[model samples]
Target chain A: MSKGRIIVIDDEDIVLISCQRALAPEGYDVRIVKSGMDGLKMLESEAFDLVLTDLKMPDIDGIEVLRIVKGKWPSVEVIIITGYQTVETAVKAMKLGAFDYIEKPFTPEQILSVVKNAIAHRASE
Target chain B: MKTKVKKTLYSLTGKLILTIGAMMIVGSITFWYFLIYYQERELLKNSVKYSLSFVDYVKKSTRYGMLTFQQLLIQQTVEAIGSAEGIMRVRIFDSKGKVAYSSKKEEIGTILGKNDPLCRSCHSESVKPRDMQSWSIRRDPEGYRILNIVQPIYNEPACYTSYCHVHPKEQRVLGLVESDVSLSLLDKAMKRQKIAITAFVFGFICLISVVLCTILWNLVSTPVSILTQGMERVAAGELDYTVRIDTRDEMGELARAFNAMTADLSKAKKELIEWGNTLEKKVEEKTEAIRKAHEQLIHSEKLASLGRMAAGVAHEINSPLTGIVTFGHLLLKKFPEGSQEREDIEVIIEQANRCSSIIKGLLGFARATSAEKSSANINDILNSSLNMVRHKADFFNIKIVLNLDESLPSIRADASQIQQVFLNMIINAADAMDGKGTLTLSTRKVVENGNPFAEIEFNDTGHGVSEENIPKLFEPFFTTKPVGKGTGLGLAVSHGIIQDHGGKIFVKSTLGEGTSFFVRLPFYEEKA
Candidate 1:
C-alpha cells in the first residue's frame, strides 16, 4: 500500500508536477490536477487522505474547493499553496478548517515534510 | 454717568439757550431802562406845564387886587388859590422886593431881597424884566416838594391910567406873584409807575427768553442730538440706526447724509463678514486637500523606492529559486547519505530557502497600497489580530490585557490590511519583550482636529525601543532584534498599509518602561 493518498491542484504545471514528484518517492500515492475543478472531480471519483491546492486557479478558486472538500470529506486534510499576493487569503483559508499552508517557491523536502506530518496527523485522528 | 451729565450741560442746546437768553435779558433791561427814563422826563415836563398855568391864573387874579390897592383882596386871592389842590403857598412880591401879600400869615409882612431864594426866581439879575416869569422846585422844611412860580405884573395902559398909578407914563412897574405847589402826590404816582413798569418788563423778558429757547432747541439742539445719538450708535457697531430729523434745514440734510453713511457701513460690514466666513471655509477645504495630496505623495514615493527595485528582482529570483530548491532537493537524493556532493547540494538548497523567505518579505514591502476598503470595526480587527498572535504570545509568556471599547465606530478600511498592521505591532512588542511581558490591546473612539476616528492601541510592557532608534523603526531592514529573529519589514509594511487606509500610526516608548503604538483610522461617513 502507498504511504498515503494525496491530490495536488495548481494552475501552474511546474507546481503541480513538482508536488507529485516530490511526494511520490516519499511513499505517498500522489495525484496531480491542473485546475481546482479537475481536483474536485478527482476527489469525488476517488478517496484521498490530503489535498494540496493552489489558491488562484483558472476554473474555480482554491477556497471554494477547500470548502466543498471539508464539507463533504471532513476527515480529509487540505494544505493551501499561496504566492506572495495570496498569502493573506491563505491565512483566511486556515480559519476555514484548512490544515496548514505552504508559500510558493517552496522546496521538495519542505512539501514532503509537511505532507508526512499531515498524513500522520490524519491517521492519528 | 458724570460725563454724560456734563456733556448735556454743555451740549448745543444748553449753549444756544444760554447765549440767546442772555442776549434777550440784556436787550429787555436796556429797553426797560430807556422807557423808565422817558416816562420820568414826561412826568417832569407835565409838572412844569401845570406850574406855569397856575402862575398865570394867580397873576391874573391878583392883578385886579393889586391895581385897586386892596391888600386884603389880594391876600384873600393868593390864599384862595393856595388852598386849591396841589398848591402849597402863593404870595405876591411888590416891585420893591417886599412881600405885599402872603398865603402864610407869618410871611405877610416879610421883606425879601432880590438875591433871596424866594425872590431870586424873578430877580436873580437886578431888576431884569425878562426874569419876571420863572418856575423853581424846592423842598420845604416840612419835607414837602414844592414848585415855585413867579409872574411879574407889568403896568398896562389901564394900570397907568388908574388912580393907583405912581410913575410917569413911560415907567414899567411890576410885582411878582409866586406860587408853591406840593409835589408829594406826583412823587407817589411816579414811584408806582416805576415799580409797575419794572415788573412788566421783567415778565416780558421771561416770555421772550422762553420763545427764543424753544426756537433754538428745535432748530439746532434736537436735530443735532439725533445726529449725535445716531453717530454714537454707529460707532458702537449698530450701523442700522438712522437719525430721524424732519426739518428741511441744514440739520436735516446732515441727518440724511448720516443715515446714508450708516447704510453703506452696514452693507460693507455684511460683505466683510461674508468674506470672512467664505475665507475660513476655503482655507479648511484647501488644507484638507493638501493633506490628502501630501499623503498620496508619501505613499507613492515609498512605493516607488521599494517597488522599483523589488519587482523584477523578486520575480526573477522567485522563478529560479523554485527550480533551484526543488531540483536541488531532487539532486541531493542522488548522492550518498554522508557524501560531500550531497552536503554541497544541501548548502545550495539551504541558501535558496533563505532567499525565498527574504523575497517574500521584500515583496510585501514593495506591494501596492491599494487596499480594498470596507466598513470595518477597529475592535473586531484588534480581536482578530490578537487571535493570530495568541499562540506566539503564550509561547513567549506574554499576558495580554484587553481594554476594548464596545462603542467604537466602524472605519472605512481594508479589514485584512488593518489586522495585518495590528499583527505587525503586536509581534514587534512581543519580540521587544524578549519572551516575558504583558501587552494591553485596546480600541476606543477618538476625535482629532474635529474628525472622528477609531483608535487601536497596543501597549507593551517590553524592553522598550530607545529614543535614538524610534525614528528608524518603520524603515525596511531596520530592526533592533537579532538578525534571524526578525525580517525587519513588519513595521515598514504596517506603516504603508495604515497610510493606505487613510490612517496614522504613532509610537511612544521609554528605554525600560514600555512602548505604546497607536493606530488611528477615520470613522466612515456614509454621505455620497
Candidate 2:
C-alpha cells in the first residue's frame, strides 16, 4: 500500500522533480504545485494526508498556506521546506501547527524520512 | 648765589635748615640792634651821672677857694678832675659864658657864645636856669664819642652871706661846669658782646639743623626708600620680594602688610598654574576618549552596512543552492550503487551542501542576533566549532592543538553565535597557513582589571601578517587571502559577534612568524 498522499509546493522545478523522483520509488502518492496558491487550489479538490510547502515563493508564502491548510483541512499535516535564509521563519511555521520544518538543500533520505514521519503522525492522530 | 639759595629752599631738609638759619640771623640782628641801643643808653646815663657827680665834687672842693676868690685853685681842681680815667675834659664857664678854667690849657679862657651847642640850651632865653642842668653826646676831634654834662653852679644863702664873695639872691646861677666823658670803652664792650652772641646763635642753628636732618632721614627717608625699592621689584614681577624695616612704627607695619599681600599673591599664582596644567591634561584626556568613541562609531556603521548586504545575498543564493542540492541527490539515487556517476553526484551534493552552509553563515551574519539566551559550556562550543572545520583542516594538512580548560564554568550565551565566531577563526587560521600549518587553540579563565573573563586564544604557525597589515586585519573587507579564497567578512563578522556578547577580540602578529587571536568574554555568574 502507498505510504501516504502528499502535495509538494515549490517555485523551483528541480525541487518539484526531486520530490517526485524521491517519493515515487518509496510507493507513495505525490503531487507537485509551483506556488502556494496553486498548492491550495489543488488541495481543495484532492484529499491529502500531508502538505509539503516551500517557505519562500512568488505568488504566496508557505506560512500562509500552512495556516490556511491547517484551518480548512484539520486532518492534513504540513511540513515546511525552508531555504537557508528562511530557516527562522520556517521554524515559526512549525509553531503555527506545521508538522515539522526542514532546511533547504536536503538529501533524498532526509526528505523521505520526514514525509514518512508526517504520515505516521496523521495515522496516530 | 641766587640759584644756590633757591636750591637749598627747594629741598625739604635744606629749606628747613635755611629757614632756621635765616630766623637766627634776623633775631641776632634785631637783638644786637636793641642791645647796642639799650647799652648805649645806659652807658650814656651812667656817664652823665658820673660827670654830674664829678662836677659837683669840683664845685664843692673849689667852694672855699671860690669864696676866697681863689680862681687859680678852682682851675687846678677842674684840671685834676678832668685828668681822671674815662673823663675826656672839664671846663668852667664864667657868668658871661667865658671859660674861666679848662682842663686843657688851650680851653682855659675860651669864651662860650649863646648860639654854641653847649650854651644853646642853658643860655637860651626860653630855658630857665634851674632846668638847664642837661647832658649831650658829641664826637670829639679824634672821632671819639663823648658825654658832656652842664651843671649851673647855684648860689644859696650861704654863698650870698659869705664874707669873701657875696651874691644877690636874684643872681643865683653863677657859672656852668662842663664835663665831657669818653664813651669808647662802653661802645667797644657792646660791639664785642654783639659779635659773640651772633656767632653763638648761628652755630647753634647750624648744629640743630644737621641733627634734625639726620633724625628725619633715619625716621622717614630710609624706610621710604626701602619700601620704594620693594615696590619696584614687585612691579617688575618679582612677587617674592619683601621689604625689611626694623622700626616698630607705621612704616614697619606697612612693610609687614605688604609682605603678607605678596605671599598671598604668590600662592594664588601657583594655584593658577596648577589649575591650568590640570585643565590641559583633562582636555587631552577628553580628546583621546572622543577619538576612540568616533572610531567605534565608524566600525559599527561599517558592520551594519555589511550585515544588510550579507542578508540580501544569502537570501538570493540559498534558493538556488537548494535546487542544486535536490537535483543532485535525485540524480544520485538514479545511478547504480557502485557507479562513478553516483560518486560524481555525491560530490555535487557535497559542494551544494557546502554552499548552503555558507549561506547559512551569511544568514547568521544578517540576522545579527537572536534574543534567545541559554547557559552553554564554552568547551562544548569549542569542540563543535572544531568539528565543523575538522575536514577542511585535514584537507589543508593543518594541525590543530587544543588546550581547553576542562574546569571552565558554564556561561550564559547563545551557542550558535559563539559557534559561528569560532568557526570563522578556524577557517581564517587555515587560510593564513595556506593549507599547511599548526593552529593552537587555548582556553583559560582570565582576570582583567578585576573582572573575571574566559579567554580563548587561537595561535597559528602560518605566514604571519606583517606589522602594517595587523592593524587593518579586523577591518571590513580587509583580507590577505587570494581573490576567490576569502570574502573578507569572516573576521569582521566574528568580531561583531564577540562584541555583541560583550566580549573582546584582539590579535598579536609577528612578521614571518605567526599570528594569535584572542577572544575574552566576561564570566557570567548565576543570579540568586
Candidate 3:
C-alpha cells in the first residue's frame, strides 16, 4: 500500500529541506514549500493526508493554513511547527483544528512519533 | 525704601541733639532774665543812697557859710569867705531881705524881698522862722534849694550900761545868709551807676550763653557725632563697631539702646544668611535624590522589558533547533550502519546538539535566568500561572482565553516575577467575576508618549474596579482581591517594571462590564 502523502511548509530553506529528507525514507511521499502561500496552492491542487506547517511565516501564517485545511479538507491531519515555542500559539493552533504542535530543534524521534500518531489516527477514522 | 526710612527714624543722634539744643535755649533765656533784673534793682538802690548822702553834705556846708557871714564885712575877708568849702555863692540880706554884702560880687547890693517865694515863706509873721532851722525850695529851672536861719545882729549888750538896755528893746535882723549848690553832681553819679549795672548784666548773659553752648556740645553734639560715625560704618556693612558714650543721662541711655539694637540686627542678619544657605543645600539634595530615583526606575524598566521579550527569543531559537534535532535524528535512524552518510549524520547530530545548547543559552538570555530567571513565553507564563489555579477556575466555570499577539517581541525578564504577575491578574479577574467569567489575555505593539513599546493586556468580563480604586490600584498592597488570594504586589511590581522601561501601565474598567490592564514597555530594536 502507498504511504501517506505529507506536505511540509517552513519559511527557512534548511528546515524545509531537512523535513523532506527526514520523512522521505520513512515510506511516505513528502512535498516541501518555503512560504505559506505556496503551501496553500499545493494543498489546493494536490492531495495530502497530513500537512506540517511552520507557525510563523510571511504573507500568511501556519494558523491560517491550518484553518483552511480544516475547512476544505477536514480529513487531513494538520501539525503546527514553530521555532519559538509558546503556549499561546500552541493553544491557538489547537483551537483552529491543528492536530498537534512541534517545537524547533526537536529530536527525530519526537517528530516521527507525532506524525505517525496523526497518521494512525487518520487511518482509524 | 523701607529700610532707609526705618534707619532715619530710629537714629539716636537726631533725638539727642534735639533735646540738648532745646535745654540750652531755655537755660540761656532764664539766665538772661534773672541777671538783668537783679543787677538793675541793685544799681537803683545804690544810686538813691548816694543821692541822700550828697544832700546832707550840702546842708552842713550851708550852716558853715552862715557862721562865716560875721567876717564877711571886710572885702578881703568876704573874698576869702566866697572861696569857702562847698559854698558856690553866699550873701547877707538886711531885715527887709535885701542883699547887703555878697560873696558873688555880681549879686552884691541886690534886693531880696518878700516877692521871692523862698523869702516870703521863710519870713512870714505866721511862720516861726527862729524855731524852723531850714527850708527847701522846689521850682522849675530854679531846681531845688534849702534855706538856713536868718540871725538878729545887735551891738554887744553892756550889762550895766543904759544904752545896752535900750538896744535890747531895739534888736535888728541881719541879712539872711544863702548858699547855692548845683544838683548836676548827684545826677552824674546816678547816670554812672546805671551804665555800670547795664555792662555787668550784658557780660553775664554772654558768659551764660557760652557756657550753655559748651555744655550742649559736650553732652549732646559729641556723643551724637560718634553715633553718626558708627551708623555710617553699619551702613557700609560693618557690624563690629561698638558705640561708647560715658554719660548717665538720657543720651547715654539712648546710645546703650542703639548698641543693643545693632547687636540684635547683626545676629538676625547672620541667621538669615545661614538659613538661606541651608535652604539651598536642602534643595540641591532633594534634586539629586530625585535624579537618582529616576535613573533607577529606568534601569528596572529595561530589565522588565527584556524579560518580556525573552519569551519570543526562546521560541525563535527553539524552532530552528527543533528542525536540526529532527534532521540529525532522522539521519541516525536511516544510516545506523557505518557509511559516509552515517559520519555526516553523526556530525549533524553533534552540531544539532550544539545548536540546542545555543538555544538553551538564548533561552537563558531571554529569561534573565542567571539570577533566578528562566525563559518563558507569555502564553506559557499565563498558562502555568493559571494552571496552578486552573482547578479553581474550572470549578467556578471560569473560561480563560489568551489572545497573545503573534508578533510579540522576545523579552529578557525574570520568569517567576512575570508568573507572579500573571497569577495575580488571573486570580483578580476570576474573583471579580465571582469565579464565573471570561478572562482574556491580549498583547499588542504600542507606542506611549512617542516611545515605541509592547503592550500586554489582561481583560476580564466581570464586575469592574470602581473609579475610586483605579488610582490606588497599582499602589503596593492595594487590592480588591480577597485577602487570601491576593498579596497586592502584582500590579505594583508590574507598574514598577513598566516604569523602569520608561513606559506606563494603566487600567480601565466599567461598572458591571469588565476590567482591562495594559502594561507598556519600551521597544527593543534588534541590533544589526
Candidate 4:
C-alpha cells in the first residue's frame, strides 16, 4: 500500500510537477492541482491524508484553503509552500493550524523528507 | 504703551501771543507818552503867557501906589487883584526884601530873605529850580496846587524924586512880587486826559491779544498740531496716515509732502516684502533640490557597492558552499546508517550549510531588508538584542552594562531590522573589545530642533579608530578586520537601514581610548 494520501497545490505547473516527482517514488500517494480551488475539490472527492499548498496563487490562497480544510476535516494536516521568507506569514500560518511551511527552491530530498515527516505526524495523531 | 505728552515751556501759539502783546504794549506806551508830553508842554506855555501879562498889569497898577508911598492904596490894589478868580495870593516886597504889601493881610508884615526861592529868582539869577524853569508851583495848606509867578520891581525916576527916601538911580531892581495862581482846573483836565489814555491803552492791548490769537490759530497753531500728529503716527509706523491740514499755507504744503512720502514708503515696503518672500521660496527650493540630489547620490553609490559585493559573494563563495553541502549530502546517502563515517559527513554538511546560510544572510543585507515599520520601543529592542549577545559577551569575559532610559519614546521602525542592526553593533563592540573589556548599551530621548528622536548608543572599551579612518567607517566593504574574519558589510548595511527609517547612524572614536556607535530614530506620533 502507498505510505499515505497527499495533495500538492500550486499555480506554477513546474512546482506541481516537481512535488509529484519528489513524493511519488518516496512511497507516498501524491496528487497535484494547479489551484487552491482544485485542491479543495480533490480533497472533497477523495480521501486525502495531507495537503501541501502554495501561499500566493490565482484561485483562493493557501491560508483560506488551509482554514477550510481544517474546519471540514480536522484529521488532515496542511503544510504551506511559499516563495516569501518572511517570518510573519509563517507564524500566521502556524497559528492557523498549518503543520509546517517550507521556502521555495527546495531539493527533491528536502521535499521527500518534509512529506515523510508530515505523514508520520498524521499517523501518530 | 502710550506715553504722556509733556507740556513744553512755550507752545507756538504762546510765542505768537507773547510777541504780539509785547509790540502792542511798546507801541501804545510810546504813542501815549509823546502825546501826553506835548499836551503838558502846551498847558505850561499857556499858563506862563497869562502869568506874565498879569504881572505886567500888576506892575503898572502898583506904580502910583509906590510913588505915593500910600500903603493903604497899594494894599487895596493888591487885594483886589489877588481876590480875582484863579488867584491864590499876591505878595509885594520892597528893595530891602521886606513884604511891604500882600494880598494876604496876615503876611503883610512878613520879611522875606534874599535866599528864599521867591527872592532868589530875581536876586540870584544864576540858578533855575530843577524842573521849575521860571515859575514855581506850590501846594496850599489844604493841598490845592498853586503856580507862583515872580516879577522884579524896577527903580524909576519918580521913585527917586519921592519924599520917602528912594533908592539911587543905579538900582535896576527894587523888590519881588510873587503871584500864586490856582492850578486846579489844569490839574482836573490833565487827570481826565490821563484816564482816557489809560483806558485806550487797556482796550488796545485786549484787541491785540484777540486778533493775534485768531490769526495764529488759523494760520499756524491748529494746522501745525494736526501735522505734528500725523508725523507722530508715521514715526510710529502707521505709514498709511495722512496729515489733515487743508490750509493753503506752507504748513499744508508740508503736510501734503509728508503724506506723499509715507505713500511711497508704504509701497516700497510692500514691494520689498514680496521680493523677500519670493527670494526665500526660491532659496528653499534650491536647497531642497541640492539636498535631495546629494542623498540620492550617496544612496545610489551605496547600492552600487552592495551590488558589487553581492555579485562577488554569490558567484565565488555561494557556488563553493552549495557544492560542498551537495557533495556531503550525496556522501551521506552512500554511507551506512549510524556509522562513524556517516556522522563525520553530517558534520561537514552541517558546517557547509551554515556557510551557505551566512552567505544568504549577506545577500539579504544587500537588499537592506524592505522595512515593515511599526511603532516600536527602542529599549525593548535593545533588551532582546542584548539577550542574544549576552552569552557571547560572557564567554569572552566581557562585562555588559545596560543604561536604558525607561522614558524613551517609541520610534517608527522595523523591529526585526532594528534588531539586526543592534545585534550587529553588539557583536562589533565585542569584537572591538577583543573579549576583554566592557560593553555599555544605552537608550535615551533626545530632541533636536524641536523634533524628538530615540537615541541608542553602544560603547566599548577597545582600541578606538584613528581620526583619518573615521569617515570611511560606513562605506561598504571597508573593514579593518583580517581576511575571512568579517565581510565588513554589517555596519554599512546597518547605516543604510537606519537612514531608510528616517534615522541617523554615526560613530565617535579616539585612538587609544574607546569607541561609540550612535543610532537615532525619529519619535513616532500616531497619524490621524
Candidate 5:
C-alpha cells in the first residue's frame, strides 16, 4: 500500500528538518514549509492526508491553518507541534479539530507513532 | 497670683493687753477716788473737833467772868480762838435772841433770829429744840465755804443765884457759840493730789502697754510671720524652702517638722526622676528589639512566597528538559554504539541532567525541607556553581573573572542554597550581556553592625536594567525576557535563599553600562 501524504509547517528550520527526516523513511510523501502561509499554499495545490504544524508562526499560526483546512477538506487530519511555552495553544488547536499535539524537540519515534495513528484514524473514517 | 492674709486689730495679743489696761485703769481710778474722799473727810472731822473744843474752853472761861458780869473778858476769849487759823467767825446769842458777843465787830449787838442759819440747825419747824449744840456748813455768795457752830448755854443754879443777878431763881438764861472755817487751802491740796495720782496712773498705763507690745512681738508675731512666709513659699511650689524659728515652743517644733518633710519630698522627687529615666531606656530597648523581629518576619514571608514561585518555574523548566533528554536518547538510538555522534549526544544528555537537578532542588524547597547548614567558604561555593555554568558561558561568548580574597573567613550556611544563589547571579549576568560580555565575581571580608561578613560581588559588563525596572528586578514574575525565555523567578529565588542564610543581596547598576550585585553573609564566630 502507498504511505500517507504529509505537510509540515514550522517557523524554526531545525524543527521542520527534524520532522521531515523522521517522517520520510516510512514511505510517506512529506513536504516541508517554513511558514503557515507557505504551508497553506501547498495544501491548495495538492491534497494531503495529514498536516504537522507548529502552533507559533511568524505569519498565520497553526490554528488558523487548521481552521482553513478543516473548512475546505474536513477529511485531512492535522497534528500540532508546540514549544514548551505554547503548550496551551497546542491544546486549543486540538479542541478546534486538530488530530493530536506533540511537544517540540520530540523524539523521532514519538512523532512517527502519532502520525501513523492519525493516518489510520483518517482511513477508518 | 499670691493672696495676702488680712491683718486685724483684734489680734490675740492686742485683746490681751487691752483688757489688762482697762482693768488696771478701773481699779486705780476707784482706789484714787476712795483715797481722796477718806482724807478729805478725816481732815474735816479733825478741824470740827478742834473748833468745838476751843468753843467749850471759851465757854468755861467765860462762865466765871459772866458770874461777875465780865462781858469784855468773854468777848476777848471768843475773839481770841475765833481768829485762829481755820476759824472765820465766832458769836454768842443770849436768852433774848440777841448776838451778845461776836468775833466780827459788826455783829456784836445784832439780834439773832430763830430762823438764822446757826439757830435753824437747832430750831426748825420739824423740831423746836430747848437746848442744843448745832453746826452747819454753807457756801456764801462769795463762793467761799464756811462752817458755823452753835452751842446753847442753859441756866444753872450758880448763875441764877449769883450775887450780881439777885432776882427770882425761876428765870433761865441761855446762849450759843458758833464758828466758821475756811476750806480753800484744803481744796487746793486735794486738787494737787488728784493731779499727781492721775499723772502717775497715766504713766503706768503707757509703760505697761509698751512692755506688752514687745512681748507680743517676741512671742507671737515674729514666729507667726516666719511660719506664714514659709507656707506661702511652699504653696508657690517652692517645696525646698524651710522656716527657722529659734524658740523652744510649738512653733519651733513645727518649723523643724516642715523642714524634714520638705527634705523627704526632695529625695522622693529625685528617686522618681531616676526611675522615669530608667523606664524610658527600657522602653526604647524593647521597641528596637521588636522592630528587628518584625523586619525578620517580613523577610520570612517574602521567602515563603518566592519558594512557591520557584516551584512553578521549576515545572516549566522541567518540560523543556524532558524534551531535550528524550530527543537526545532518540538521536543516540539512531547512532552506532561508539560513534562520535553518540558521544555528542551524551553531552546533550548530561546538560539535560543538570537542568533536572536544578528543578529537583527547587522541588525540595517546595517540600519545605529544613535548611541544613555547615561551615562553608563562600569563595569555594562561588567557584563550584561557576564551574557548572562555565561551558554555557563559553558557548555564549561570556567571560568570567574572579578576584576572590584568599584570607576571607567561612560562614555557617547551607552550601547548596548559597551555590544556587551564585549560579543564578552568574547566569543572569550572562543573559543581561546578550551572550557577549564579562562577568567578575569577587569575595572579601567586610563589617556591618559590628559583625564580620563575607562579601561577594558579581559585576557584569552588560546593558544594565533601566532605572524604572531595577527596583522590580527581584520581584517574582517580573521580567524583560520574552515568553518561554524565562519565568522571571531566578533573582527572586536567589534573593530568598540569601536572606534565608542571614545574608543580604543588593544591586547597583548604571544604564547601558553594567550591573553589580553584592551579597554579604555574616561570618561564623566560634564560641570561646
Candidate 6:
C-alpha cells in the first residue's frame, strides 16, 4: 500500500521545519506549509490522508482547516497542535470533528502515535 | 471654676490697679482743683485789699491836705496863704456872690455870678453856707481847684445864727475860701502802685502754675508712663514683664501688683504648656494601645480559624479512612486471592481507590499549597462552588438564585482558591438559612473608593446574626450552630483567602431576617 500523505501547517518556519523533519523519517510522505492559505491551496490540488495544523496562525487557524478538511474531503483526518491548552479550545476542536489534539513540545513518539491512530481510524471509516 | 478663678485673678490685679490709679487720679485732680481755686481766691482777695488800702491812703492824704488848707484859710487865708508849702492860689468869696479878695489880681473885682452853680449855692437868698463846707472844680488851665470852708459871719459872737437873719439889710455875710492844687503827683503815685501790685500778682500766679506742672509731670506722669509700657508688654504676651517704680506711695503699690500678676501669668502659662504636652502624650499612648488591641483581635481570630480548619481537615480525613477500612474488610471477607472470587475483590479494589482520591483531596486541603493565579472567569468559580455544594443544597431544600453579570471582566486570582472561597460562602449562606429559605448570589464589576473591582454578593434568608454578634461574624470558631454541626472556620478562612488576594469581604445582617455578604476582588490588567 502507498504511504499516507500528511500536511503540516504552522506560522513559524522553525515549527514547520521541525514537524516536517520529525515526520519525514517515520515513513509518511510529509508536506509543509507556512501559511494557512498555502495549506488550503495545497489541499485543493492534492489528496492528503491526514493534516496536522497549529491552532493559532495567520489567515486561517487549525480549527478552520479542520472544518474545511471535513467538509470538502471527509475521508481526511485532522489533528490540532498548540502550545497552550484550554478546556474551551479542546471542546471547540472536538466539536469540529478534529481527530485528536497534541500539545506543542510533544515527543516524536507521541506525534507519531496520534497520527497513526488518526490514519487507522480514518481507514476504518 | 476656671472662669471664677480667672475673674478673681483679674479682679485682684485689674480692679485693684484700676481703682488705685483712679483714686490717685481723682485725688490729685481734687487736690489740684481746690488748691488752685482757694489759692486764686486768696490771691485775688489780697490784691483787692492791697489796692483798696493803697487807694484809701491816697484819699486820706488828699483829705488831710484839704483839711490843712481849710485851717490855713480859717486862720489867715488871704495873705498868709503865700507862706504855705505848695499852695498856688487862694481866694475868698462873699455871700453877695462877689469875689471879695483874690490871689490873682485879675479875679479881685470879679463877681461870682449866679450863672455859676457853685456861686448860686452860696449866694442864694436862703443859702446856708455851713452846709456847703467844701467843693472842688477843674480850672480852665486843667488845674484842680478846691473850694472850702464856707463860714457864716454872725451878728453875735457865738450865736448859731441863721443865714437869713445874719444877712439882713447891712447884715453880716459868710465868705468862701477857694484853693487850687495840682493832682499830677498823686496821679503818678497811684499809677505806680497799681502797676507794682499787678506785676506781683501775675508773677506769683505764673510761678505757681510752673511749679505745679513740673511736680505733676515728675511725680505722677512719669511713673504712669512706665506702668503703661509694662502693661503693654504684658498684653503682648510677655508674661514676665514687670514695672520698676521707686515711689513709696500708691504708684509703687501698683508696680508691685503688676509684677505679681506677671509672675502668676508666667506660672499659669508654664502649667498650661505642661498640661498640653501631657495630654498629647496620653492621647498618643491611648491610640497605640487601641491599635495593638485591634491587631491582637485580628491575630486571635486567625488562630481560631486555624484551629477550626484543622478540625475540619481531621474530620474529612477520618471519613475517607473509615471508608478504606470498611472496603478492605469486605474484600477480605468475600474472597481470597487467585480464585474466581478475585473478580469481586477487584471491584472492592476500585472502591478502595475512590477512598484514596478523597484522602488526596483532604491532603490538598491540609497542605494549603500556593495557588497558581491566572485570569479566570468568575462564573466558572461560582459554578464549581455550586456544584460542590449542590448535594447539600438539595438535601436542605434551599433554592439558590444567581444574578450574575455576563460581561464581568476576569480577575487575576488562583482559580481553586477563589473556588474554595465561593464554596465556603455558599455553604455559609445555606447553613444560615437553616436549609430552607432562598439564597441569592450575584456578581458585578464596580468601582469602590476609586478602585475598580469585581463584586460578588451572597444573600441568604436566614435567622440572622444579632447586632452584638455581627462584628464577630468573621471571627474563627464563632458559630451559631449546634455544638458539633459547624466548625466556624468557613467564614474566617474565606475572609483570609479573599484578603490575601487583595480583596475584602463585608457582612450585613439583621436578626431574624437575613444576612448579606459582599466580596470585592481586584481586576486583572493585561500588559500590551
Question: Candidate 2: global Cα-lDDT?
Answer: 0.81
Comparing 5 and 6 on TM-score, the stronger one: 5
TM-score of 5: 0.45
Model 3 regions lying over 4 Å from their true place: B1-281, B297-528
Runs in model 1 with CA error above 4 Å? A1-125, B1-9, B118-132, B139-145, B155-162, B167-173, B210-231, B243-255, B289-528
lDDT by residue (B205-304, candidate 3, tens digit) is: 5666577657766886788888889899887878867799978998799889888888988999899999999999999999998997887666556545
Worst 10 residues of 2 chain B by lDDT: B364-373
Can you tell me which runs of candidate 4 are displaced by over 4 Å? A1-125, B1-9, B30-34, B64-73, B115-117, B120-133, B141-144, B156-165, B304-312, B315-318, B321-528
* Candidate no. 1 TM-score: 0.47
Model 4 over residues B230-306: C-alpha lDDT tens digits?
88888898988887877677988998888899999999989999999999999999999999889867775866576
List runs of model 6 lying over 4 Å from the truth: A2-4, A70-77, A84-103, A120-125, B1-528
- Candidate 5 DockQ category? incorrect
Candidate 1 pairs with clashing backbones: none
| Model 2: CAPRI class | acceptable
- The residue-by-residue lDDT of candidate 6 on B1-528, one tens digit each, is 999767644653445545555555566556555655665457445443443343233333333323343533333434455344434555556556666555565677678676576555554668654433443334445443322223333223322233333333444434455554334444455456556655655565556556655665566767877888999999999887789997899989999988998999999999999999999999999999999779856765655455456535543343333334334444555676677776766666555444444333333333333456788999889988898788863435988799999999888888877887888788778778778889999999999778999999999999988889987877766888775456565666676667667888888888889999999999968765
Q: Ten consecutive residues with minimal summed lDDT in candidate 3 chain B?
A: B151-160
* lDDT score for candidate 5 against the true structure: 0.78
TM-score of each: 0.47, 0.61, 0.49, 0.47, 0.45, 0.38
Best by DockQ: 2
RMSD of each: 15.2, 8.1, 17.2, 17.9, 14.2, 18.2
Scoring each candidate complex against the real one, what DockQ results?
Answer: 0.28, 0.48, 0.34, 0.03, 0.07, 0.05
Interface RMSD of 4: 7.1
Q: What is the TM-score of chain B alone in each candidate?
A: 0.55, 0.56, 0.39, 0.56, 0.51, 0.42
Local error of candidate 2 at residue B206 (angstroms)? 7.3
Pick by lDDT: 1 or 5, better one: 1
Total residue pair clashes for candidate 2: 0
Query: A63, model 1: CA deviation in Å?
Result: 52
Give the better candidate number (1 or 5) by TM-score. Answer: 1
